[model samples]
Target: MSDRSATAVVLGGSVAGMLTARALASVGVRVTLVERDALPEGPEPRKGLPQARHVHQLWSGGAQAMEELLPGVTTRLREAGAHRLPITTDMVGLSPRGWYRRWTESHFMLLCSRDLLDATIRAQVLADPRIELVERAEVLGLDGTGSAVTGVLLRAHDDTRRTLRAELVVDATGRGSRTPHWLAELGLPGPEVREVDSGVAYASRIYRAPEAARDGFPVVNIQPAPRTGGPGRGGVLLPIEDGRWLVTLFGTRGGEPAATTADFDSYAREQLRHPILADLIGQAEPLTEVAFTRTTANRRHLYERMSAWPENFVVLGDALAAFNPIYGHGMSVAAQAAVALRESVEEFGWGTPGLARRLQKAVARPARAAWDLAIGMDVFYPGATEKGPTRAERLVAAYVDRLTYTATGNGRVARAVTDVMSLERGAGVLLTPSMLLAAAVGPLKPALGGPPLTGDELKRAGLQ
Candidate 1:
C-alpha cells in the first residue's frame, strides 16, 4: 500500500471503470466513480449501455484476472446463473477453414447476460468503503496543463457544474470518450489513432431453450470465411442465464442482418456459413424481439506512442481500444488491463513521476494483442479499411490462415490457437519454432465431415 492517502477519480461506471475502482481501493486510494447514467439496482439494463443486449463471454484469461482482482467473482457469477463453458469441448465452432473438432478442454469461458456480469461486478466493487459512486454525472473536461492532470470538471444530475480535484484521473468512458479533445484543451498532442471498421451490423434476440437442452447445451457458432470474396456473415447461439439462448447474427455491408423480428431466423439459417445455429434455434421459442447494432469496429488510440503524456492520467477499456465484439475480447481485455493498472500502481507507487505514462504502456500490451486478432480477419472484408490490409497484415493473415486450417484436424495445433484466442498467452506463442513446424506438418487427423455435434446434443435439440 502507498504511504500517502491519495485520491483518484474514474470516469464511466461500466465494467472497466468498476474494475479500476476496485484496484485503486484495494491499494488504499479513495476512488470516486462518476457515471453519466443512473446505474441499475440489479441485473437490469442501463440507458447508456445499449450493447448489453448482445451476446458476451469472458474468456478464461480474463476470468482468471477477474478472479485475481475480486477473488471469488467467478463463483459469484456462477452463483448468479452464469455457465462455465470449456473451450473446444463445450464450444462447437466453425472456423474459416472448417469445423473445429471438440478437442479436450485447454481453456474455458464464463457465459452470462452482460447485465448480470456487470451487475455482479458493480455490487462487489461498490461495497468497498473507500469508493464513492456519483450517478448521473457528466464529465466536461480535464483540469490541468499538458504536463499533469490535476482533476476533472463535472456536472451532476441537476446540471450544476463543479471541479473535483484528484491525485489521478482515469478515463474508462468507452468508445465515445473525449480524451482527445480534452487533451487538446490541455495543449498536448493527440495520440495516433487507427480504426478498422468492417461495416458489420448485428441482430440479436433471446429465446427460451428447448426443454431438454437447457441444462448443458454447448455454444454453437458459425464464422464467415472472409477470403470467400463476398460479404462475410456469421452467427452465434450463446446459452446464457435463465435457460435462454442469446443468439446474435452479424454480416458486413451488403449482407447485414435484418432489424425485423420475422427475418432473424431466416438470416441465421441462410446467411451463415453453416445451418447449425439455425437448426438449433428453430427448435427454441423466441423470447425477445431482435436488437440490432452497427458498431462493430476495431479502433485503437496509440497512447503509448504519444510523445508527451500527462502525469496522473490514464485511459483504459474501450476508451483506449475498442474491438469488434464478435471475437468476444472486449471484456477480457478490460479485465486484463485492470490487472495491468494494479501492477503498475504497485510497482511505481501512486503519484510517482511518469507513473501514468508507464501504466498506459502496460495496459496497451493486452489491447494490442486483441486488436491484432480482430483486424487480422476483419481487414479482409470489403470496405473494412480505407486502404486494404497493409503488406505486413497480408503476410500475417496468410500465416494465420495456415494455422487455422491446421487447427481444424490437429489437437495440438487447436490448443495452440485457443491459447491465443483465450487471451491466456501472447501471440508470440503461435510463432514459436515448434508451432511453425506443426503448421507446416498440417493436421494430423482427417477433416470432420460436418459439425461434430454429439447424438445426445442432436436429440436434446430435437434434431435427431
Candidate 2:
C-alpha cells in the first residue's frame, strides 16, 4: 500500500494514541481514533484517567518529541498556563542517599495539570483533516489470523458491532489492555511478561498556593529510601497553573497513606522523610478532596521477543509497558515510542514485510531505558517479586546507588545522572571510566542536613 493511500486504526484516545494518530497522519496515512469515553471538550476531567489527578510532568526529552510530532505544542501549552521549569535549577529533591543540590540546568520539565496538557495536545491533533475520531466505542478484538491483522472488531455504545478494515492497527490502550487475550484467540503464543509491584498507594490533593509562592516556585520532591528495609514513603509539591499547588503523598505496602483529608497532612508531616511538604500545604487553602489510587506497578510485555509475529499490528504506550508513576517516565517513553513509529514508517515503506515486528522492537528501546530506572529501585522493595531481583539487577542497583550518592554533592556527577534521569541519555553514560572514578571517590562535600530550599522560598511558603 502507498503511504498516502494507507489507512490506520488507533485504539484508545490516550496521550499515546493521540500522538500515534498524529505521527501517522504526518506521514500521509489517514487515521481513525477509537475511544471508549466521550472525551472532554476542554481542560476538564474525563473518565478512565484516574491517574490524571496526580502530579504529571513532561521531561524535556519527551517534550521535544511531542514538539516534533505536533509543532508549536509546547507553545500552546504555555499559552494555556503551563510552566517550563528547568531541571535541578527549579527543583528541590531529597533522593535516597541525600538531598540533591540545585545545579545548573542540564535539562527541564514541562509542568502543569495533566488535564491541561491533554487538552492542548488533543486540540492540536484533532484539527488535522487526515485524522478522524470515533468516540464512545469499544474495540472487541483484532480481525485476522495470527500471521496478520486486517482490521478490528469494534462495538459502538449502542451494541452495534462492525469490522473496520485498515492497513494498520495500533493498540495504545493503557494498563487494562486485553491484547494478550486477543492474541491467544488468534492462536498466537503469549508474550513474556514481568511485573514489579512496589505496593505504593498515591493520595493527591490540590491547594491554592500562598500568594508569594504562586509563581516561579520550585518543584519540591521528597523521594523514598527503598533500601531502608521498610515500606518506602515520599511526597511531591508541584506549583501548576492557576496558582494551585498539587501535592501527592505516597507510601509502599505497610506505609500507604490514608485517603481521608484529615490524614493527608499528617502523612506528609509524619510519615515522609521530611516535613516541608506538610508545612507548605498548611499555609495554603485546600481546593479539592484527596484523590487516591494504588494501581502503581511496573509491568512489561516482551512482544518483540516473540518468534512468530503478526503484521499490520503494533502495540505502544502502557499496553507495551507501564511504569510506576513515582518515576514519572510513562508519558516520556510513550512520546518517544510514537516518534519511533513515525520514523519507522518513513524509513521503511508502511507495507514492508516484518514492518510490525520492526516497529515493536523500535518502540521497546525507550521503554527499556525507563524500565531499568524504575525496577532498579522498586525491585529492592519487599515482595516486589516472588523470586526477588536477579543477580544482574542487584549489581546494577549497587552501582546506581553509589552514583546517586556521588551526585548529591558533585555538580558534574549530578549532571550526568540527570542526563539519564531525564531520558536524554542512556544508562551506559554512568559506566564511563570518569563516572566510575567519581562514584568511587564519593561526594566532594558533606551531605546536606535539610532540603536545599532557598531562604526566599522558605519565607514565601511561610515556613521561616
Candidate 3:
C-alpha cells in the first residue's frame, strides 16, 4: 500500500500516456493526463498520430502486459473485430536467406487498425475514477531546479496559463517530446543519445479483402536483404479489421516507394525481394489513398546512465526511445515499460527517495532489449549512421545472420528466434548451450525455394 495520498501528472494522452496513468492509478495515485489535442470519443484517427494508417501489431508480450493492466481488454478488442494471429503458424514470411517454413505456434500477435487499438485501450484506462484527463492543454515546461521536479506549467486552450503541482511528473509525449529541452531548462545535463536512421520511407493503403479470404488470412511479408550492398525494399500485407487488408511497402534511401497510388502495386511486386504481397493484393479492391511517412528512425536516450537525475521526473515510451516501425516493437515496449513503472512504485512506494531513478532504469530494461533487436539490422543499411557499424556491432550482426539463416530450415531455431522477436524472452535465450549447438549443426533441411503458403491460401487469393 502507498505511504500516503499521492498525485501524479502524466503528459500526453496516447497509448503510452494512458497506460502509465492506469498503472499509477492502480497503485493508489491520483493521475492527471494532459493532452495537446482533443481526444476522439470513439475509434477514429487523431491529428497527433499520423502513423496509425500503417501496419501495427501488438505481440504476445505486450498483449499479456495490457491484459494485466486492464482486465478483459483483449475480449473487448476481439468483440470490436481485432484478430489474434498465431506466431509463425499464421505468418508467411520471406527472410533474406530464404522463405521460412510455417512452424507450430510459439507466440501470438493482436492485429487491428491502430485507431481501434488505441481507442480501446484509451477508453478502458480513462474509465477509472481516479484518473483525470485535461485535453487541449499544452505543457510549457518543468517547474523546479535540476535536483527535483516540483510540477509542470501548462497553457489551456483558452490561453489561460497555470501550474499543476504534483508529487511526480511523467513524460509520454511520443517522439516529438521536448523532455531534453525541458530538463535543460532546469539546469540538468542531457543524457547520451544514439540514432540509427535507415532513411526508410513507408507507403500504405487499405484494401477490401476478397470474399473467401476475409475471415482467415495469413500475413504475408517480403523482407529486404541488406547484404546485397545496395538499396533495401520490403512489403507486408496485414489483415486488419472490417475485412480489410493494410498493405505497407517500404524502402531505404535510393529504393523508397513512390507516393502515387498507381505505383503501389508495382513497387510491391517488382521492387521487393518477393512478389507474394503484390500477387495477393493485386486483385483486391483498393479502399484508400496512399499514406506515406519518412519518420522511421531508431533512437535511444541513455537516461539510465546519467550521472545526476531529478527526484520526481521520468520519461517513458517514444519520448525515451523511438524505434523503426518496421520491427513493430514500439507499442510492446511501451506496455512493458508501464509494467515496470507499476512494479517499481509498488516495490519502493511512491515518493520514496530515488524512486524516479529506479523507475527509469527499470523501464529501460525492456526498451534496451527492443533497441538492440531493431538496430541489429537497421545499422547495416547504407548511410544509416554517421559512422558505419562498429566492430562489435558487425560481429553481433554476423552471428544473428547465421541464426536467421538457420531458422529458415530448422523448427527449433525458428522458435528460438521468435522467442526474442515476440519480446516474450530476452536475447539471452539465443545464447544458451543448446541453441549454440543447434546453430553449429546448421539447418536440418534444405532452404525453401518459394513462400510456404498452403494451397487453400493460394487458391483463395486467386494465385493458383
TM-score of each: 0.99, 0.99, 0.99
What would the per-residue lDDT of candidate 3 be over residues 5-104, giving only the tens digit for each residue? 7999999999989999999999999999999999999999987899999999999999999999999999999999999999899999999888898999
lDDT of 2 by residue, 1-464 (tens): 36358899999998999999999999899999999999999999979999999999899889999999999999999887898999899999999998999998999999999999999999999999999999999999999999999999999999999999998999999999989999998999999999999899999999999999898999999999998778999999988999999999999889999999999999999998889899899999999999999999999999999998899999989999999999889999999999999999888878999999999999999999999899999998888989888899889888999999999999999999999989999988999999999999999989999988899989998888
lDDT of 1 by residue, 1-464 (tens): 65778999999999999998998888889999999999999999988788899989999999998888898889999998999999899989899898999999999999999999999999999999999999999999999999999999999889899999999999999999999999999998888999999889999999999999997899899998887667999999899988999999999877999999878888987778888888888899998889999987899999989999999999999999999999999999999999999998999987789899999999999999999999999998999888888999989999999999999999998999999999999899999999999989998888888998999999999899
Candidate 3 residues lying further than 4 Å off, grouped into runs, are none
lDDT of each: 0.92, 0.93, 0.92
TM-score between candidate 2 and the true structure:
0.99
Distance (Å) between predicted and true CA of 32, model 3?
0.3
Best by lDDT: 2
Candidate 2 lowest-lDDT run of ten: 1-10
Give residue 85's error in model 3 in angstroms.
0.5
